[model samples]
Every structure is written in structure tokens, then in C-alpha cells.
Target: MLWLDLEGAVNVRDVGGIPTDDGEKITRGRLLRSDNLQNLSPADVTYLVDHVRLSTVVDLRSPAEVAAEGPAPLTRLGHITHVNHSLLPEHGFDATAEALLVRRKREEERFPGDPSCAHYLGYVEERPDSIVAALRAVNRSPGAALVHCAAGKDRTGVVVAFALTVAGARREDVIRDYAATGERLHLILDRLRSSPTYASSVDSVPEDHHRPRAETMEAFLEQVDKRHGGVLGVLGSNGFTDDELDALRRRLRT
Candidate 1:
């Protein structure tokens, strides 16, 4: 896990240098995952544009979240390609936060184990097209692709996990990358709490709700294997062609 050390986002990291099954590593700076980019400082902008050379922004945030937050600093810039792929159905974006929470509670009740994992499975079942679109956006990026949602743990994690798995990354390496976000939970939660759009959504929530657990990601991958067959199976069923999948692997792996 290569931390980017950005001033605005606390959970930003390059999903690179992880050893794959066949001994190659995912290329650094090709794929990045992070929290929101709405508060990027001027220096942060310079670092991302000049040093990171980020060319694509795969925003996994809902339409409501984007509308509520308005344009991020990078979105204001003309150079970067912005792709919107909300992992929820179209009507889902219209739901109120209370409604969203109720839906989450219902998912937890239905799944009966890890609430986070259950919600992730919902993401798979509900709007797989958006997830596939996000992956294709990453594959199409001319330079580093920064994939993000509000907190960048759940949505980003699920998408990145798919990409890494498709690229033949080891399961342990995938779980390690997902678990790395727990190290910055406080900073991530604080950033979210500072935002008017997310502060209320997180207030009074349990600590476990905010933190990423390895077990959650472990279970998610297992479900991906059992339920969807695998990354290739999931993406293929969602209309990702063999060429695009190959392009994705080539873009991320060395």
C-alpha cells in the first residue's frame, strides 16, 4: 500500500506494487483510491497534477452526494476526465440519507453477518453496470486513474478489489490493501464529519461502521468467487468484453 500523503484526502493511496500470482506487481501511479477530492488544497492539486499526473477521476459517489457537494477541485480543472458511476440504481440516488440508512439496516437484517459486507453484496446485485463502468474508466485512463467515493472505503474497495483480482493479484495482498484503510479511519472520519453532507450521516454511528475490516473484504471476495464466479465472470456478465478486460489488466499490471 503506497500512501499518497495528500493534504485534502486522508485515505488516498496508490493501489500498486502488490505482488501478483505470477510474480509481477501492479504498476504504481496507474491506479489510485481515495476519499472525496472536494477540499483539495492548491499544493495538493499541484502534487496530483504534476507529480501524480492523474488523468482520470472515476467518481463512485451517488448523484445526490455529487449534487450536495458540488464540483471538486479536480472537476473544476479542464484537463482531467471525470467519469460518474454511482454503484446504486438511478432511484437510489434520490433516496434521503434516512432512507439509505434504513436500506442498509434492511440489508444487514437480510444478510445477518457483517453489515459492511452485506452492503457490498448489495452493491454487486443492485448496480453492477456502474461498477463495470468504473473499471472500464480506469482501463481507459491515459494516466493515473483516481477512483473515489465519499469515504473511498466501501465503493472504492469493492471496485479496486475486482481490478486487482482480474489482474491476478494474490488474495492476501488484496485483503491487505483493503485493511490498510483502517489505519487512517480517524483522519477519514474527521474529514467526513467536517463536511455538511456527510457529517449527519456518520454522527452517532458505531466505530465499526466507519472502519474497514479485513474480514469484511475477505468475505466480499469469497462471495465474489461463489456468487459471481470471479472478477472476470462478474464483469463479463455485465458486458465487459474480453479486450477491455485484457486492457484493464495491462493498464494495471507490470
Candidate 2:
């Protein structure tokens, strides 16, 4: 993971040069992952748009988040294609507090030992269509594809992991990439706390609770394997065709 030092988003990084199981490397500048882009400075925008040549933004944020946050800097750029594929259910942010609690409880029950893993699984189970569409957007990006959610942790991690897996990246490398966000948890939390859309939720939890764990990702992948055969299986079952997977692999691999 190559970290991009941007003023607004701390958890931005290029997931390039990662080795695949077949001895190939993921091409640099092809795919990037980031937290919210709501506060990006002009220079940061220039760096991403001009220097990085970012072409597509796969925003995994819920509709409520996008509406709450309003237009981001990237959204104003005429050349960039922004695709919103919320991995969570549409009612995610609009639900009552009690309803949210009930959903979280059900997610925990999905994998009693690891709530994070279960939550990740919920993305696949609850919104597989979004998952497939997000991957398709990445594959079709004209240049670098930047994937992001609120904190660039859960939803972003799941989608990026699926893309990496489809690109033939090694399992350990995928888990490592997912856990890389933990290194910037403090910055991520700070960014979230500054946003009215996420501030209250950020304050309600202990910071450590937000840290991404390698074990969680490992278990998530294991469950994916067991339940759907693998990432490709999950995508296939969700209407993502083999030809699209091949195109994604070709787009990501060197």
C-alpha cells in the first residue's frame, strides 16, 4: 500500500505493486482507495486529477451520506465520472436508532465471534447488486479508479478486496491491504468527527473499535469462500459475468 499524503483525507493510498498468486503485480496508478473526499484542498484535487489522473470515483457511501455531505470537490470536476453504489441498504442512515440497533444485532449474530467480519458480510448479502455495480465501474474507469466510503474502512475495504481478488491478488495481500487502514485510524476518526454527517456516530464509539483488523478480513474472506466459493463466486452469483471479471483483471494487472 502506497499512502497518498493529502490534506483532507488521511487514509488515501494506492493499492499498486501488490503481487498476485501468479507472480504478476497490480499496476500502479490503476486503483486507489480513500476516505471521504468532502474536504479535499485544491492542491489535493490537482494532485488526484492531474498527477494521478484519477478518472472514476466509486463512492460506496449511502445515499444519506452523500446527501448530508452535499457535493464533494471531485463531483464538481467535469472530467471525472462519479458512481454512487451504496453497499449498505438504502434505509441505512434514515432508520430510527432502534432500527439501527436491531440491524447491528442481526449482523453480529451473523458471525457472533466477529462483528466487523459480519458487518462486512452484510455488505455482500444485503447489497450484492451494489457490489457488482461498483466493481463494474472500476473495470470501466478510463484511468485510475478511486474507491472510497466514509472512513475508507468497511465498505471501501470490502469493494477493494473484491476488486483485488478478481485481479488475482494473493489472499494474504488482500487481507493486508484491508488492514492497512488501521494505521491511519486516528486520522480517519478525526476526519469523520469533523463531518456533521458522521460526527455523532464517530463520538459514540471508542476509537479502537473502529480499527480494521486483519483477522476480521481473514474471517470475512473465509466466510465468502465457504458461502459463495470466493469473491469471484459472490460476484458471479450477483450477476457479474465472467467477461466482466476478465476485463477487471486485465485492467488491474500488469
lDDT of 1 by residue, 49-98 (tens): 99999999999988988999998889888989999999976657578788
Evaluate residue 94 in candidate 2 and report its C-alpha lDDT on the 0 to 100 scale. 79
Worst 10 residues of 2 by lDDT: 87-96
Reference-based TM-score of each model: 0.95, 0.98
**Per-model lDDT:** 0.89, 0.92
Q: How displaced is residue 49 in candidate 1, in Å? A: 0.8
Number of the predicted model whose lDDT against the real structure is largest: 2
lDDT of 1 at 186: 87
Candidate 1: which stretches are off by over 4 Å? 93-102
